[model samples]
Target: MILPALLGLGTGLSLIVAIGAQNAFVLRQGIRRQHVLPVVLICGLTDALLEVLGVAGIGLVVERAPTLIEAIRWGGVLFLLWYAWGAVRRAMRPEALAAAQGSEASLKRTVLACLALTYLNPHVYLDTMVLMGSIGNAQGDPGRWWFALGGALASLGWFALLGYGARGLTRFFATPRSWQILEWCVAAIMVVIAARLAFGGIEV
Candidate 1:
């Protein structure tokens, strides 16, 4: 039991630690101190839902649905490419980026934006449901839930820490040069991930 719980914890923490769009949004929100709780809650809940789906045999379904998977794969690739372009454009136009330093968008708009950002990439479900679920299944039934729980906990813990901690780094990220460098790095990462997803062979 302990071993399964530890395994789940490790697996969950490892997968969620990657710098994905959700994490990026959390970081930006932390810096701005805007809609932090809602963002964190949405991310955590979304993760939990996907993790449950994964453990409930959705992973197997995804594995067998090659056409659906392929469609999602291409869609994810396109979205990443589009996001990368936006990041590059923002980096190029520092003034435009700075202009929105203090967004006054309504809470409803913020929530919706967070939801769209969280759910837009179909790969997110693939990663959590298919990949993580398959991993949990290896531990057998009783242990599987424990593993899912561990992963879900990791999602909550990591996002909360990241979103809140980034607030302290706002000073460092304030400079135009800093934004430019960060945006460029984000663009590079997005492009690389997109390429990998589009061209790399399936491992799981």
Candidate 2:
């Protein structure tokens, strides 16, 4: 049991620690000090929920429904492109990046964006539902539950660390130039992820 749990924890962290779209958004929000609690909550909870579904054998159902995946894929592509455009626009204007300096976003909008970042990306489904799910189920009945628990704990721990730990870099982002560079990085990440999703590639 302990072995399966530890295995799940290690595997879960390995998959999520990559600088994906969700992590990028969470980092930005953490640095901006905007709706950090809610954003992390949604991310952690959504990940746990997906893992549960996957472990419950829903992954099989979802796998058979390529149409649903395709719809989500396209939606994610459009949203990511739009977000990338915003980042590019901000990068072009240092003032726009500076606007986030000590700025706060509405809770509703922030939550919505967080949801979009969480759900629309096919990678999330592939990772949490399909990949994590398959791995957890392979642990066998009782062991699988322990595996899921480990994975869920990992999500919560990671998001909490990411969302809160980001403030440590607050001093660095004080400059407009720093914000511009950050926005450019975010834009690049979003564009690349969007392209990969469109092309049916999940990694990166």
- Return the top candidate by TM-score: 2
Each model's C-alpha lDDT?
0.81, 0.89
Over the stretch 112-185, how does candidate 1's per-residue lDDT look in tens digits? 76786677656677778888898899989799998888888888888899989999989988777787887898
lDDT digits (tens) for residues 2-76 of candidate 2: 998998888889989999889999999999888999999999998889988999998778777788888989999
Tell me the TM-score of model 1.
0.86
Highest lDDT among the candidates is held by which one? 2
All-Cα superposition RMSD per candidate = 2.3, 1.7
Model 2 segments more than 4 A misplaced: 201-204
Q: Lowest-scoring 10 consecutive residues by lDDT in candidate 1?
A: 96-105
- Show model 1 residue runs off by greater than 4 Å: 105-113, 120-123
Q: What are the clashing pairs of model 1?
A: none
